[model samples]
Structure formats: C-alpha cells, structure tokens
Target: MTMFSTIRLRAAAVLASFALALSGCFLSPGKFTSELVFTGPDSFTFSYEGEIFFLGLSKLAQMDAAQAEFTPPECYNQETYESQECSAEELADARANWESGAADRAAEAKKKAEQMAAMMGGIDPSDPKAAEELVKRLKRQKGWERVVHKGDGVFDVSYRVTGTMGHDFMFPLIEGFPATNPFVQTFVRQGGQVRINAPGFATQNPEQAGMGAMMGIGSLAGLAAMRAELDGQGDAMPGIPVIDGTFTVRTTRGMRVLANNTDEGPEPNNTGEALTWRITTRTAQAPTALIALIP
Candidate 1:
C-alpha cells in the first residue's frame, strides 16, 4: 500500500470516531480537537469549530472517469478490433511503442514538477500570514485547496482535476499518493497565482465487455495499480494516471461556490438529467484572507 493509502485508512478511522461522537449513538473513549485560525490584510478571519480530524480525499477525477465509462455505454467504443488491436506478435510491438510514448510523457511531467519546486524558494511556514497568503494565491491561479494538515505530520495535498468546473470538479493527482508517501510540502507563487500538483492514479475505464476480454492476462485491480506495477511485469498496462490541477479559496463560513460555467459541457437536459460536477473544497479553517499562490 502507498503511504497515502495508509494515511487514508487512518483518516477514515478518525472520521468514523467523529461520526460516532456527533451521533451520540455510542460513547467514545475520548474527543480530539484543533483550532486553525486564518487572518489576512483584507480583514478576513476563518475559524473552524468541532473536533476536526483529517478525512482522506476521494479522487473526483478517478470517480468521474469511472462514471463516464460506467453509466454511459454510448461514450466509449465497443468495437472489438482496431489497428491498435492485433495478433500477439503485433501486440508486443504496439506495447513497446506505447511504453516509449508513456516514458516521454513521464519525463516531461517530472521536469515540470522539478521546475515548479525550484521556484518556491524559502518561506517561513510559521509566519502569521502564511496560510492566508497561501490561500489567496491558490485562488488566483485556480488551483486546488484540498489540504490535510496533520499537526506535525506531512502536509497532504489533494489537487483538483484539470478539466472539471464547479461541483463537477474532480481530482487527478500528478501521481496518486503512494502507499508510503512523504513530503516537505511547500507553496509556490507565480504570475500572481499559485500552482500545485498531487499524486494521481493510472487507470482505463474501457467498456466492461472489452475490458473483461483481457482480464485473463491480469485483473482490473492489477492494471489500475500504478506505474510501479508496470515497470517489469509482463502484464497489460493501464492508461496513464490522470493529473488534477485547480484554483481554491477559503471562506469565512464553510459555504463556498465553485461557480459552474456554461463552457463546462453540454448543459443538462432538465433538472433530472445527469449533472456536471463542480469542483469546490471547504477547509476546517474559515479563510481570514485570500491567498492566490500555487501549491
């Protein structure tokens, strides 16, 4: 399992505990609490109430991709054969080509991430205005605000999907959090905005029938695992993981609107039609000041 998977398990446990306490359904051994105060030059203050515990982020991008492939049969190609489809000998050649292309993409992503890191430089995390300024910059860049502050633990980031708008927002990490993840989390500001990238999952949501046809080679779970799984294994590969990026804002009240746009997609047919996802996040802390930097 990746460090994130493990953290998710733990975070879930915390939420479970909170749920129990809130319900008064059963007594718990203890109650935990933390206070996050945000202040800004705009004279903003955000305060979080209750025993806040980290909740592992649900990957909206992965979920949407699954939805796109699952609920709509019309969205994907059901054909059994294409040039990409071929005999075992030909499949080998195609696989080699795909792998080469994937490698180039991976190299590019790595370089971009490195360049971003290099631009952040130094900033004191303990500064009183740090969090506020950070949030403001993130909003300006339209980046993610899915952050998990674990006191002295590593800062976990969950970025929003690249293409999602409003509530339809989804997240596809640059790389999904590893089963064993670690980081010296920092924020980067550029061109009056902030940029952030999170780990992502690699997967393919082929038509069920089409996908099942190849399952004899490896299970769906195996194929969806990650790049590490495909390194030396002789199994079919999964699609490259989706990367999510976003702009986020902190609100004085928990209420927030990740305003949906007409450009998002074809509008819903009616109130009952499938709805487009909007990407929005609510932090435990009320935003005291808006920060528009990258994460």
Candidate 2:
C-alpha cells in the first residue's frame, strides 16, 4: 500500500477508537453483564466480578452492627440451680414475668425499626445496593444520564472519574435501581457499559459484638472520608479533576503513567466537554486532603 494510504488508514483507526471509547459514556440497559479483563505485558490478568459481587465482597470485608447481640443473663443463680424444691406457685409467677419481659423487648425492637426506616427516607435497610445508589444520585450530580423504561425505577448513567494523572476513565450505563434492601447492590460493566441489577441492604439483627461495632464505624468513617474528598476536590464541577499524583492510564498496547499528582488551581473547566472535575491532592498529617478546583 502507498504511504499516504497507510497514513490515512491509521488516522481513521485512531479516530474510530476514540469515538468508541467516548460513546461508552452514555446510559443504557438496567440489567446486564460485564467482564473486563486487563492483560498486561507480563501476561498478568485482572478480572472484576459484577457489581453485585463487588458489593457483596465489600460487605464481607466489613462488619454489620445490627446482628451483634449480647448474651442474656443466666436463668438461675447458684442457689436456684442447687434447689429444685421451689413451690409450684412461685415457679408459675417466674414464668409469667419472663414472658412479660420478652413482650416488652419485642415492642421496643419494632419501634426502633420504624424509626430507622423513617430516617432512611422510608427505605428498607435490608437493601444496601438501593441505598448506595440513592446516596450517589442525591450526592453526586452531573455526569449521570437517565434512561427511560416503562414501569421500572431504574436509571442508566455514565460516571467518569478523572484521576490525579489527568486521565479520565468512564463507566457507561451504571444503572441505579431500588430493591428490598438498600445496602447491597449489583452492578455490571460489560464492554465498558455498566448495568445495575438488584441492589439490596441488610442490617444484622440483635447486633453482634465484633462485626457490628467495628464494621459499622469503619464503613461510616470510610464513606464520610470519600464524600469529603469528592466535595473538597472541586472535581464536583464540570471540569476534569487534575491532580499531581501517581496515575497510570492503560491502553490496548501500553500505559501512560504520570507522577507528582498536583491540582494547579489555575486550571479551568473546559465547558466544551461533557463535564470535568479538577482536584488537587495534598498531604497534611497522616491523611490526604483534596483541595478545591477552578472552573
């Protein structure tokens, strides 16, 4: 082939690839499957499970508070254990008191459950994924696109994260959905398009000791930190988040790696694009803080 013809063909291929990547940033179906395999130069393969599995895995890593419960006091003391000669009337009274106490506990539990449901916007705590999607939509705006499907409370969306390396990765069709529980969610990313199925949330009943307290605290703290980082980064705006940190963008054949992630305030949002978020990462003490962005 002639040199000019080869050059034209190469240019067309690059343009086509770019368009395909960009188009993947739109909303699509609600329930779908995805498998993303990253093969590196060393034959390294990194596989990601669907969004439901991801959320489930995350839950496994954390603890649930509601399920942890304390053991009831012993039914009998040394004196009671030793003596089996209690009067029939006395035994009957003891049984009556025990039942009354159990009833009271049940009532209190019901009231607490109602209160929690009200606080969560009338959502059931048993559905974690639904809750996660609700929080995401309520908190993060812009990039997400809504898809229309009859009789379905599902949304098709595109979520983009511009890393500190000045590169953007777009997740297309990340569906937002509701389910019985609000904590657990199912998300799928296929061919760059992500779909969300049934998301569920659950709280441990009666609450356990280790998993309940520690996991509850950690999840709260972690989510709070993430929200704060996003809020402070100014990447919440319509511009890309540009940080001076270690960033590596992988392509079909190679990777563009950057270091010294810095978000220069002078950066402005390019309105010509869909949306951008500019963020500056700085180290204060043991934790890192994301500063504001311009434009």
Which candidate tops TM-score? 2
Q: Write the per-residue lDDT of candidate 1 for residues 1-295, one digit (tens) a residue.
A: 0012332342233222322222211100001111111122122221111111111111211121222221211121235422232345544664566556665555653543343222222222334444344334434443444444333211334332222111111121122122121110112234322222211111122233233331221112212332224333543322322211122233233222223221243232322112122211211111121223212
Candidate 2: Cα lDDT at 135:
43
Give Cα-based local distance difference scores for all models: 0.25, 0.27
List ranges where model 2 is wrong by over 4 Å: 1-94, 124-216, 219-295
Model 1 is weakest, by summed lDDT over 10 consecutive residues, at 24-33
**Could you estimate the TM-score for every candidate?**
0.21, 0.23
Residue 122 in model 1: lDDT = 24
RMSD of each: 19.8, 23.4
TM match of model 2 to true structure: 0.23
